[model samples]
Target: MMTKSDDEFLDDIFGTAKAQPTLVPDDLMARVMADAQSALVKPDGAPKQSLFAGVFDIIGGWPSVGGLAMAGVAGLWFGVSPPAALSTWTAELIGVPVSVDLFGDTTAYFAETQIDG
Candidate 1:
């Protein structure tokens, strides 16, 4: 069992106390308010940046823009020229002369093999 004086002692030792007042001088408050008011009143006569300038800034800042451009050019060149070269190279590697007749003249060779009775 605890005594009343012990409880009172604990309260006096560990209880929450009221905080002291924080003081702000009048001159500092006036200066801060004046600065804020000046920032709020910007001059509309200032020159604005163009949309093109903004886009250029973004594209120029991107680290991978040059890499992307190079990849695009390489992709376009490969797209236009690779499949035909690959087919020709494959045919040559397999020991056959690869001939492509795009206007359908190669079908004449097939007509010569007629049906026999």
Candidate 2:
């Protein structure tokens, strides 16, 4: 069997044929444009949000609101009942004796110190 060159094999397979162009019908193009125009048109009298609602939307909705509420509550709790270390530090700074009980009432201790001093 004789071996054929690469160009000879390709030319034999393709035979210099040009592909035919495809055209979309005018009716189909018109329908597509009409659908696109309808989609692009805005509805009449769209509902407007209040300033607060717009701000909430900018901050990413309900999860962000819940997170902000939780942060506020945490801040309030920490402000009312500070950590043990902070209390100890404050007591030392004020020349007051530190209490032995970790969860003891700090107000009672301060009252006793004030009475004794």
Candidate 3:
């Protein structure tokens, strides 16, 4: 059970009073308005970026570009001719027969399927 002192302490911290607006000094308010107006104004000119720099920024920085290049090369390599291990893994995953030289047969899985013969 909560004590009365604890209840009073909680009420003091989270009082039911509404928030009241505080008045700002005229000089400080004027300075704040001036700063806001200055921030809204656009600069006259910015330095031009080269085509390569602009393209680089658009596709993210050097790290992202390097990753993309590596991914592209890997994709091309896999598309042209995948390695034997990858083929074996995919074949096992898909439960399909792979024509790898020594250890690619799925004869063991024949028991799992209901073949009439």
**Model 3: per-residue lDDT, tens digit, 1-117?**
899999998887666443445679899999999999878745665567899998999989899999999999999999899998988998888978657655345554565465745
When sorted by TM-score, best at the front, the candidate numbers are 2, 3, 1
Winner on lDDT (1 vs 3):
3
Task: Give Cα distance to truth, residue 57, candidate 1, Å.
Answer: 6.1
Q: Is candidate 1 or candidate 2 better by TM-score?
A: 2
| Top-lDDT candidate index | 2
Kindly indicate the candidate among 1 and 2 with the higher lDDT.
2
Q: Candidate 1: TM-score? A: 0.30
Q: Write the per-residue lDDT of candidate 2 for residues 2-85, one digit (tens) a residue.
A: 457877887766765534456899999999999998788466656778999999999999999999999999989879999999
Find the 10 residues in a row with the least total lDDT in model 3: 13-22
| Candidate 1 lDDT tens digits, 3-88 | 99999987776654434456899999999999998788557955787997778677774665777889999989877877877768
**TM-scores for all predictions:** 0.30, 0.42, 0.37
Candidate 2 global TM-score: 0.42
Order the candidate numbers by lDDT, best to worst: 2, 3, 1
Worst 10 residues of 2 by lDDT: 13-22
Candidate 1 RMSD to the correct structure? 10.2
Best by TM-score: 2
Cα-based lDDT at residue 113, candidate 2: 100
